[model samples]
Structure formats: C-alpha cells, structure tokens
Target: MIGVDTNVLVRYLAQDDEAQSPVASKIIDGFTPDAPGFISQVALVETVWVLTRSYKMTRDAVADTIETLLRARELVVEGAESGYLALASYRATKADFSDALIAHGGRLAGCRETVTFDKGAASAAGMRLLGAD
Candidate 1:
C-alpha cells in the first residue's frame, strides 16, 4: 500500500487549492481496496487539526469526515482498531482528537492510564491528571 500524506487528504477534501486538488483527487481516485492508500496515525491527526483549526470546520464535521475516511474502501488507516476507539471517545466527550488517540494508543500498549497536564485530556480522554489534586 502506498502511504498518503495529510496534504493530499487536505487538498482533496478542501478542494481549495486550484492546482493541487486535482492531482490529489487523481491519486486518491486511483486507489482500490486491493491496493489502497495508507493513512498513518500522524497524518490522521494532522488532517483533523487542519480541517478544524486551519479550515474552520466544526468539531462534528471533522468527526464525520474522519469516520468516513476510516470506512473508505480505497483507504487503510493505520492502527484502525485504536483509531476507532479514539473516535468513540471523541464522540462521547469534549476531548481533542489527538488526545483521544493518545489515550487509546496507550490503552492498546497496556498502559493503566495515560497521564497528562491538559485538563481536557485528563477529564475527557481518560487520562490521569498529572498536576494538582
């Protein structure tokens, strides 16, 4: 499987860049389930950040888009089981997608709980608060 970058997904999803969108679309369109494009965890997180922070997409929209990507026949998301767990956490709480992913990955690696300083992560993403009582 060929690895895809976040830029390619952004270009395709945004369709904002005149020159690159078509190129990105062409590459994505060429993908098949038998030889699908691979999206790594890093790219997935970056894509969510860009779609939300940079493009001003709503959190719900970003969640929907990510869920759609995870289900795409022409794409393969790395660590898909953990990714889905993160997605579920994202839906059920106000945690950031990246934070949810971190917690999920930690769980998969046999961590009892992830520790973090971020309040949202600690409260919403199942991480233990690292400071204060």
Candidate 2:
C-alpha cells in the first residue's frame, strides 16, 4: 500500500500544475477496487490546508475535495480525531494553533521532534522551527 502524501492530493485537486497533474491523476486512478491508495491523517489535514490557503479554494471546494477522497475508499487514516481537531482549531485560530497542535500531536505520537514554520510555536515549548527558506 502506497502512502499518499499531501502534495499528491493537492496537485490532483488543483490541476494547475500541468507537469504534475498527469502523475497525480494516475496515482488517484490507481485507487480502483483492485488497487487502492492510502493516505495518512496528516496528509488529509495538510491537503485541506493547501486546498484552502495555497489554491485559494472555497470551503465548498475543499469539502468537495474531501468528499472525493472519502469516496475513493483507498485512503487510510490514522489519528483521525487528532487531525480533525487540529485542523478545526488551526482554522479557528487563524493558523495560530496549527503548529501548536502539530507539536502536541507529535509528542503524543511519540515523535522525537516537531518541526514547524511558526516561530511562536517554536518558542512555546517542544517544537523546533525550521530555518527560513
């Protein structure tokens, strides 16, 4: 079972990047009854974030993306509750809670380190901020 990453779903939904769309399409299409695709909870949450923020998709569009993924039956998720709650709180906090949840969830999941882009989150407690790129 191949693990689907957030970028794959984002590219499939966005369809704006010509170079990667065919690859994304093929990957998604492979999730047939015989050959199913798989995705993690983190990918699901990140996909929503990318769809809304990066692609400028509306809430309805984001919902449609999620619906399509759910219908695929190929996607598998872990920590569904954590992902949902993290996304919800992140959205509610206007992105402020994203890193916090990521850090907290990572710790709960027994990760050694939680990497993030938010400086505030890095300073909070257990998160490590990535260098500016």
Candidate 3:
C-alpha cells in the first residue's frame, strides 16, 4: 500500500493550488482497487490542522473533507471512527468546550487512547501525550 501524507491530501482538497491539484488528483486516481493508498493518524491530524489554520476552512468544511476522506476506498488509519466523532463534537461545542467534547467523543468511539500535543487535551480521559516531551 502507498502511504499519503498531509500535503497530498491538502493538495487533493484545495484545488486552488493550480500547480499541485492536478498532480494530487493523478496520484489519488492511480490508486486503483488493486493498489490501495493509506494515510496515518498523524497525517489526518495534520491535514485537518492545515485546512483549518492555513486554508481557513470552516468547521463544516473540515467535517466535509473528513467525511469524503472516510468514504475513500483506499484510505487507512488507526482511529478513523474516533476522529470523525471528535470532529462532529468539535463542531457542536462552544470555543472553550470544544476540547472537552472532542475528548468525550474519543471515549465514546472506543478509543483505547488519544494522543495530542495540547496539554489540556492530554489531561482529558483516554488522552495521552503524542510524545514524552
């Protein structure tokens, strides 16, 4: 299986990048049923972060992107269901409550553990630091 990174996904989603979108589309299309493409949990997280922060996608747009990603035939990840639920919950909460809702959704989706760089999120149930640092 071929592994895709956040940049690839961003290029696929953000067609505004004239130089990269076509290439991204070609790469995505090349992955037929015989040859599947995969993406890691870290890639998914980074994709969302980039879409929201750099591309200025709204919460709804992010959710839509994630839903499209989940529907793809070849994508792979560890906690896809949990991540989807977390995104949904993130959309519903007030700014201050978003992390709490994400944590709750993570638990509800049967996540054995969640990893985040945010200290507050790390303290939430079922969450752990992405690294010891």
Q: Please identify which of the two predictions, 1 or 2, would achieve the higher lDDT against the true structure.
A: 1
Error of 1 at 73 (Å): 1.8
How high a TM-score does candidate 1 get? 0.95
Q: List the residue pairs that clash in candidate 3.
A: none
Tell me the alpha-carbon RMSD of every candidate.
Answer: 1.4, 6.0, 5.4
**Candidate 2 Cα misplacement greater than 4 A, ranges:** 79-133
Q: Candidate 1 — which pairs collide?
A: none
Cα lDDT tens digits, model 3, 9-78, are 8899887788998998898878865787887767777887898889898878877887777667766654
| TM-score per model over all chains | 0.95, 0.57, 0.68
In terms of lDDT, the poorest run of 10 residues in model 3 is 93-102
What is the TM-score of candidate 3?
Answer: 0.68
The candidates, ranked best first by TM-score, are 1, 3, 2
Top candidate (lDDT): 1
Better model by lDDT: candidate 2 vs candidate 3: 3
Please, what is the whole-model Cα lDDT of each candidate in the order they appear?
0.93, 0.67, 0.70
In model 1, the runs with Cα more than 4 Å from the true position are: none
